[model samples]
Target: MRMEQLASRLTLKRAGNLVCSVCWRRYKRSSIVHQWSRYWITTRAQSPSSRPSSSLKGPAALGTQPTTPPITKKQFPSQLELRAVQRLDVLLEDCQEFLQKEVVPTEDTILDALKTCRKLSEYFRSVKDQPALSTIKPGGEAGNLLFLDADPADTQTASSRTLTPIAVGRMASSIAEEAMDKIAETIKRIAVDKNVYITSKVLQEVVDILCLLNRPESLAYIFILYSSKPVPKPNQRPLKYTKANPDRITAAIPLKVAERALDAAIKVQNLPLCLDIIEHTVSTKAYKRAKTLRGAFLPAVAVAMTPGAAYIVASRLAEMQEAMSTSMMTVIGTAGIITYIGTTSTLGFIAVATANDQMQRVTWQAGIHLRERLVREDERAFTDKVACAWGFADPRRRGEEEGPDWEALKELCGIRGMVLDNVELMEGME
Candidate 1:
């Protein structure tokens, strides 16, 4: 009886060791315990009749575990993200209020709203593909902590919040499209009434939007306002106007903005407007060192219009031949002489006009100013026509003192050594 008991105990101990070794190997390799291995070993060790099988092929033979889907981490908004959302909400509210108000908003108010609208548009574009989360989940400790400090008011605010970047952007865009006339009027008022310095960054943002809206006329208007020289004090107050003591005129906008305005004018193909822009550029003090006024402005016009001038000369010569029975050689010689004189006078005029006042005085005394009188009285009509068509305002005709605007002569728009380039718009020559 003792020997049988000993043999049974040995067999049970051996079976227990085999099951433990297999489980221990599995745990070492896979880092997970087989659930049934502990129970099987204990039952066999106690009973000894149901011996563990050595033919066991490991944890796989115990049947597969009931497969479970993974528990994915839930995303929650960080403090920074929450703050950004709050800021965006406030901006949208302000913008909506501005849009709904019947009265036109102030310049600062309008500017603020515009900036908000732009921010919303940009934000929507950036996050268009991203999933939006409205609220935190109630299951997790992180989610509970996220809303722990929130009062009833915050909860109500969160619940009532209807603003989204896309919604705000669309609202602003649609309102702008619907009431463009009012927008134009407001912008015109801002340009004329407000003297406060608007940064080029803001101006550029507005300009880009205007371009997108296809409001070229408004763009042209803005260009004219910014680029053109401000009306002299005397012009503004006609009672104070005097030819000899006229107030100095300076442009309100800086050089770069003025250039943008010129491009805007040219885009609209408004010749008179182009001439006005050129006049402003010529008068700008920054272009003094360059040959903008003397070499580029008038000279470019003279060159471009030379063909038309030649045609006029040829027509006159033919008329003279028919009336006086003159030879073709005489007519051709007359035309050549006229062309030579005209070209030489134009060059000489440019040189003298750009010279010091003393030199201009000498040239004036040398009867250079008398050249216009020697031309036929009939040609005066043609000259006036050309001047009118080109929108050329003779600086000499203006009796104002030719002095720079001392106050505005400093570096503008934080730019140093800036100069307006010579861009000759020959749209009217056709």
Candidate 2:
């Protein structure tokens, strides 16, 4: 009977209908506890005590003070800085356009634009590199401000466009008195800071512009800068325009430009500046030796003329003694001395002032120093634009024809006896 009962219990447990007494008791207890927990949670949510703690409030909760967000300082554009960038941009564009067309901007346009550049540069410095600058509008592609890159792809156009605004502006007409200081500053930046190669054309144009502006002193300063290989800062390591400092790096500027610069200096009566330009221009060894020899001009002329004057006076005195009264002799002697002295003095003056044999290959009066240099260098293009500002003869129709008028040049220069002899004229004469 006991075995049968045990077997029946095992079979019931395996058949999945059997539940353990301990498990049934635990289930009843869990159901009651769950009900009670749900009731407590609902009550807690309704009560004000379950609200978020004030101690857990924001950034202040982590032992930190509550603070307002930082204010970003606003940037305002400087009128000067904005104006400078805009003016520079436009001027550069106009220059590039003119270069592309193989033409030049009008004198007025160039002058105004350059003045703007000067003003811009002035303002930039006056502000002491302030960050408050206006944003420049997107224009065409930005160009090289210092120089034009040699583009191999467009060789033909490249040669034509071998110029920059700085180059063009440096050649512009009539800079103002106030803006004069800025010129050296700008050039120093170009020469020292940016350190770009100033082309021959650019330098030639500078000569032309300086002539127009009547800035011979400035021209002399520029000539010195040109003479330097990597141009020095103004007043720093200043190079002397002397034969001792022969230009080994920079290309020699065309003789025509030198002539123009000399003319400008002479017009302003800046003799020292004139001499400096002359010294800087001519570098040949023969000229150097000849310059040294030229120191004897006064002595030579004095020696030659003193005897002639003495002979005339002595001969007059002897003749008067033989042929006239004391009073008449006195008058004749005085007249002869005066005439001889005056004539000799005048001739000596002319020779000293105008002779090419002097230390200065070209004198202030002769105005042919550069031409002489060209001839000595055996430069073939003696009549070219770089040599003289004339074509062989007038190409205009007869009545309207305008050719090289030596008289007009003389009158324009206002020099009493201006002698302009070009290599072409000399060659033709030969």
Candidate 3:
């Protein structure tokens, strides 16, 4: 009762002044007390006891009422966020388990052995947490905890032994197909989820594997493009398809894969990969992206476009770069010139590659000339057109009459490095 009286009196004292402006000396304590009592008496209208209870019917009654509830731990995210982290942990564990038990081990011998071992080691590591209540059931009823140190040598790995060529080829194709299918699904899922969290290379091993497998085709195209500098005519089939069968199945499997690979290659801005893929695309005649055989020629425009190769050739073309024709240098002693255009030292990779290709054109002409000479030695004129394409000068005139430039051209392409001494008597060319 006394405590209630103290409370009521204190509340009244505090409330009346509002800002506590009343100085204790100027306003007598008894006077302030009288004013507060009067104010409460008027407000509550309760019994005039020493204890003017807060329960008295007025604003004072509700002033001491319990406030808006304080928030509990349940109302905040502290516990929920922890739960989410736990869920992610569980998801990771589940993924490990799925890979171990579900995925059939690949028998491909070339797959990195250490990588597969680490994969297994990581899978069963979560078994440490789950305490077992049963004896025979063991640590985890879901699955037996894999014994890490159980056996060493006998463990069957992906790279246990080298595969036969036939088996290796089949395995390679299967691996590629698997990766392609997986990546396709993954890309689709990412699109569906609108997810940006997913990354390339690490999680997308499947995609990387598939991309790497398609590398042979990529390499082939690079070789072809490197050899053939000039883009073919619009009428040319595949730009360099079997000149024999220019109109084959224009759209094929390898061609489609190569096109897709090029698309991805451009996105990542990978030069080596792009160069390789471009080479392969050209070699395999895999220009499925092009609607027609002629359309594939667009890639030719971009060939040797990489800065490292192109700028080096462009910047140092004068004294900076020169063709290295060692054979020509051997025949024509460097009188004034120390080294000819095709010398080993001065010649660029591009020049070497170009010369080699020009040589192939020479061989092709030789073959046609051989055929024509067999049928009719008469049409020497037709062979001249073929000869011109092979860096060969006019056939009508003698060497001196053809002029200095023509003679130089002839000297440069002399003998074509053919081994006439060891020529097989069986084959006519030999």
Candidate 4:
């Protein structure tokens, strides 16, 4: 009877019929145990040590651990930084356009624009390592300020578009005096700081602008910064041209600076500055070498006839004449007279002779006879000075020591006897 009851209960439960509570509980317990067994088996199968090496090689595996994603580096500016740069670009563009229209901005406005430009320049230098703010053009009616890059083709056309102005002209107008003062200050600072952006060419352009504005005092300050100790600050006082500071523009320029400034002054026809540089060159013994003396002579004489520059001209000419005489003698003693004359004539000696003739004419016209008398009076002494100036060893002192080999010296002088005769024959034919 018990077996018959049990079998009947089981059949009812499996058929989904009503069952006793104890039998239902027993059925749920068995289902739970089966699930637990399956889970334990899965856990053992997925153990990392039990996994195959090939399976672990790929990114996904049965027992693969969760990995932290790689950290990436940021290479470029952020959106906010880029937006700020764009704003700066727009500000510079507007400032440039305003100055290009020949309308000088007020002192405050100019300063603000310059500050923006400098900030942008600093940013560019830090980020890009280039002179970002240097592309300013001095454009407008007078065109007296620094110029910006322009299309070469557009320059010939009346329909050419106006260029962007990067910086205001120092002397754009009389009111720009304060702006000019600030520029001078900035330049001095740049020089002291040795800022690479303000290149020698850029400094030259600044000097050119100062010269154009007729600011000799400020120009003098620029030249002084090149070679003097304790660079003097730019004076805020208005520059005044006066007799006391006649050559103040080039007053403290060093030899190298003076040489370059001479060319610039001559180009602009700044007679006083030219003469001042010449005097500096002479007084500094800067022309002690034959190469430098030769290089400076033509340019010095080119301006010698200018009113107050006559003395400078005459002095340079005398020195040059003396040097030439000494060089000629040295060459003749070493290479024979024919080779010396031929060599000298070819290498600008003819030009120097012509310049001498021109100098005589200029002196005659200007009523300057002192230089002529001085040259004539000290001819022998001048020759000796030239010889000494060139550091030539005295043959007399050498006594019995062999002098310079004439044949060797002649070869070095570069003309053969045959070539000389051919040239003479050609001249005769002509």
**Among all candidates shown, the one with the greatest TM-score:** 2
Tens-place lDDT per residue, model 4, 236-262, is 233222222323323333334444555
Give the lDDT of residue 380 in candidate 3: 22
lDDT: which is higher, 3 or 4? Answer: 4
The Cα local distance difference test for each model comes to 0.37, 0.39, 0.30, 0.33
Model 2, range 1-430, lDDT digits (tens) per residue?
9977543332111112331221211221332111110111111122345332431123233343434211100000212222334445555565445434422234454445445454444443333322211221112122222113323321121113222323222212112232333443343333322223344655665565445544557666566566554532323333322232333434455567877877777677554565556556644343344443454567678667765675566665666455667566756665677677778867865665444442211113444454343233312121122213322344232123244553443343234223244333242344
Query: Where in model 1 is the C-alpha error above 4 Å?
Result: 1-114, 117-176, 179-186, 195-206, 219-256, 266-273, 281-430
> In each prediction, how many residue pairs overlap at the backbone (N, C-alpha, C within less than 3 A)?
0, 0, 14, 4
TM-score of 3: 0.18
Per-prediction TM-score, please?
0.25, 0.27, 0.18, 0.26
Better of 2 and 4 by lDDT: 2
Residue 341, model 1: lDDT of: 65
- Ranking of predictions according to TM-score: 2, 4, 1, 3
For candidate 1, the per-residue lDDT at 380 reads: 25
Tens digits of lDDT, candidate 1, 78-115:
22123234444555455555555444344576576556
Name the 10 consecutive residues with the lowest summed lDDT in model 2: 32-41
Clashing pairs in 2: none
Ten contiguous residues minimizing lDDT sum, candidate 1: 68-77
